[model samples]
Target: MYKVDKDLLAIQEARIHIEGAKEAAIELRNFTQEELDVVVNKMAIAIKPHLEELAKQAVEETHYGLCQDKLLKNRFACEYLPQQLANQRYVGVIKENYEQKTVEIGVPIGVIVAMIPATSPVSTTIHNAFIAIKSGNPIIFSPHPRAQKTIQRTVKLLKEAAIVAGLPEDGINYMQLVSSTSTNELMNHEETALTLVTGIPKLLPKLKAANKPFIYGGSGNGPVFIERTCNIQQAIHDIIESRTFDNGIVSAAEQSIVLDGPIVEQAKSELTRQGAHFLSEEEAMKLVNVLMKKNGDLNPESVGCSACELAKKAGIQVLPTTKIFIYEQAYVSENNPFAQELFSPILALFVEPNWQEACEKCIELLMEGAKSHTLVIHSNDEHVIREFSIKKPVARVLVNTPSTLGGMGATTNLFPSMTLGSTSLGIVQASDNISPEHLVRIRKVGYGVRTLNDCFNESGNQSLHSKDTQESIEVILRKIINEMKE
Candidate 1:
C-alpha cells in the first residue's frame, strides 16, 4: 500500500466526518423541540458529574487557566447553559405576530464546523455542542493541537450521552486527525453551512477563504474605568477579582485600568491592599519584552500565568501573595504592551483628569486591539454609567461588576456563552454573547397588509399632479427667477 501523507489523511478524515454530519443534520431537522431538549438535557446531566475531572484534564493538557475556574466554566456550560436554553424556542413557529398576520419560523443552519481554542477547550466544547444540538444542527469540532486530547475526551463523553439519548452517533464529532488541512477541509465542505470559530486571529483569513458564513469569537483588550463617583474599594476589588480569575485567560477580563485623578491615590491604595503590585518603569519594560512575541502577538508562554510567575519570568522580585501586577502608564499605543490584551494577570493603569478624558483613554486602548469586545465601568452615579455605556465602542459595557463574569453572563443578565461574539468594531457576525438562537435562521412569513396603491396614497404622491401642486411648483420657480433677475 502506498503511504499517504498526513495532510491528505487529515483531509480525507474531514471529508468523511462532514459527510456523516450532513446526514445527521438532516435527521436532526426532523426532531421536535421537546425531543431535542431531552437529548441536550441528558448530555448536560452526563457531563455534570465529570466537571472537575475534565477541568483537571484540560489544565494538565493545555497548561492554561486554573482547574478551579475551569470547573466553574464547565458548570456554567453544562448546568446554566441548559437552563438558559430550556424554554427558548429554536424550531418551527418560534415567533408569531398575530396583529401583523405574520409568523417567524426557525430553521437549523446545517452542519457547523466549530473550531475549539486551547484556553477554554473543554468548556467551549460543551457549550458548542449544546447550542448546536439545541438548534437542531450537527456539529464537527476541530480541536486545538495543544488541547486536542482534552477536547476529544469531552466530545466523546458528550457523543456517548447524546447517543444514549437517541441522537445519531455522528451528531457530535471531533477531528481525530487534527491539522490545518483538516480544518480547511471541514470549513470548505459543501455540506458545511456555517463555521463557528473561537480561536486565534491567524485562522481568520483561512475561514474567510472557505466562502462560508462564520461567527468569530475574537480577543478583547477590555478596559475598566473607575469614575470618581464610584466606590473605590468595591471597584478595585472587582478589577482584582476579574483580572486574577483563571489567570486572566478570559478575553473579557480587564487589561487596563483608567482611574479618575481625584480617586487615583485611593484606587492605588485599595489595589495595593488587595495584593496588587505596581511595577516600576524598568520592571514594566521587562514584562513587555516577555509578554509579546517579536511579531506583536501574545506569547503563549506568558499567557494565563499568575502575576508572581510573570514577575519571576521578567526578573522582577515580588511577594508570593501578589495576585496582580500593575503597570502605571502615561499613554495608550501599540508600542505599549500594557495597553494591549496581555491574556495574563497584568493590567495597565492610567490616570485621567475627568470622566471624559478617561472615556477617551478607554477608547484609545480598545482601538489599539480589543475594540467591540467588552468594557467595564464602576460608577455609582447613573449619569456617569449612562455616559460610558453610550460613548464606549465595546459591545458589552459592564457596570459595577467584574468584566469577566459580567461579560460571560455569570454576574450580569447577558447571555451565558463560552464563545463571545465581537460584533461592534471586531470581525464577528453578532455582537451579543452567542446562544442557540444564533445557530438558526428566522424565516419570516408575511401576509400583505397593504396594496401598492395604498403605499402611494399613504405617501401623498397621488395628489402631486393636482392643480394646487402644479401652481405651487410654478410659483416657486417664478419666485426663483425673480430673485435671480434682481
Candidate 2:
C-alpha cells in the first residue's frame, strides 16, 4: 500500500469540499421555489434571536468591532434582509401574460464561495448564507482566520437548520481549516460558480485573476463634505459614531472629514463633545510630516491605526477618552499618506477655504481606492447637496446624517449594509445596499405575435393602473434641472 503524503491529502480534501458544493448546487436547482423559501425562512428564524449573543462571540473571537454595533448589523440581516426576499418571487415563471409568453425565470448559479472578513465575521456569513439560500444555490463560507470560531459556530447552526427544513444536508458548508493555500485554490477552482471576496484592497488583484464572476467589498476611505450650512453639531456626532464604531473597522466607514470654513470651529467643538481630540495646528503639521512621505504617500503603518496610537508611537501622550484622534493639515501633500483607507478611529480633517476646495479634496481621496465606497454631505442647502450628489463619483451619498450610520442605513433610512460598493472601480455598479438579491440572475420568455395580440385585448391597457403621474413628473424635472446646471 502506497503511503499518502499529507500535502496530497490536503489537496484531496479540497477536491472533496469542492465536489460536495457542486453536488449541492445541482440538487438545489431541482428544488421548487416553495422549498427554497422554507429554507430561507428557517435559516432566518434560526439566527434571529441569537444576534446579540453572536455579536458578543464575534467580538471576542475577532477582537474587532463593538458588540453593540455588530448586534445591529446581525439583526438587520436577520429581520430585514429575509423580509426583503420574503414576498419576492425568487423561483417562478413570472408572467405578464402566460398566453402572451412574457415571462421571466430565476436560475441558480451552482456553488458560491463567500469570503468573510475578520471585521464583520458573523454578519457577513449570515448575509451570504441567507442570499445563497434564497437564490437556491449551495454556498461554502471561508472566514478570515481571525474569525474562525464565530464563523464555524454560525455555519454549523445554519447547516443544521437547513437540513431540518428538508434542504440537502450539504446545502451550506464552511472551511473549518482554511488557509491562503486553500483559499487561492478555491477561488481559482473551476467549480466555484460565483465568489464574494471582502478583505484587504490588495486582494482584489488576485480575485480579478480568478476568472470567475465575483462581488468585492468596498474600501473604507469614503470622503464626506460638511458644507457650512450643515448642522455642524449633528454632523460632528454622526461622523464620530461612524468613524469609531467597532473601532473604525467597517470597510464602508468614513475616512476623511472635509470641513467647510464657516463651520470648522463649530464642527470641531461638537466633535470634542463626542470624545474626539483634535490636534493643535502645530502638532497636526508635525504629525503630518512624520506620517506622510515627502512624495505625499501615507505611511503604511498609519493606514488603520488610531491617532492616539500614532501619537503614542511618536513619543507623545494621548488622552484616555479620545474616541477619535485628528490630524490637522493644510491639504494632502505629496509624500503625505492621506489617500489610504485607514480602518481605525483616526480621521484626516482638511479645512477648505470654500465648498469648491472641499469638493476638490474629497475627489482626490475617492480617486485613491474609494471607487465603490461612500461619500457623505451635510447641507440644508438643496443646491449644495444636489450639486455634490450629481458630481461626486462615490456610490452612496448621505444628506444631513452621520456618514457611518447613515450610509449603513441605521440612523437614517438608507438600507443597512456592511459592504459599500464603489461604482468608480466598476466592481460595484450601483449605490444601492448590497443584499442577497444580488446573487440572483433572471431568465426571460418572449411572446409570439398571436399570443401578444390576444393578451393585449384581454388585459386592456393594464399598464395604466399605476397610482399617480407625480413620480414621472419628478423624474422629468430632475433631469431638466441637471441638464440646465451642466
Candidate No. with top TM-score = 1
lDDT of every model, 2 decimals? 0.87, 0.74
Model 1, 19-111: lDDT tens digits are 999899889989999999999999998988889999999989988989999999899999898889989899888989999999999999999
Q: How do the residues 1-486 of candidate 2 rate in per-residue lDDT, one tens digit apiece?
A: 988665555456666778998888878888888788898889888877778888999887766667888888888777877766676666655445656658888887778888888777887788788878878888888778778889988888888899999888778988866667677777888998777766556568777777567776656578778898877777777788788777787877787889889877788888888788777766666666556667765554443455567677655566776788776667665344544666677788888989887888887877665353778888888987888888777777888776767776766766556565556444342346666556667788776664432433444443433444445446768998999999
CA displacement after TM-score superposition, residue 272 of candidate 2 (Å):
2.2
Q: Name the regions of candidate 2 deviating beyond 4 angstroms.
A: 1-10, 94-101, 280-315, 333-335, 412-415, 424-432, 450-486
The ten-residue window of minimal lDDT in model 1 covers 453-462
lDDT of 2 at 148: 88
TM-score of every prediction relative to native: 0.91, 0.83
Give the 10-residue window scoring lowest on summed lDDT in candidate 2: 451-460
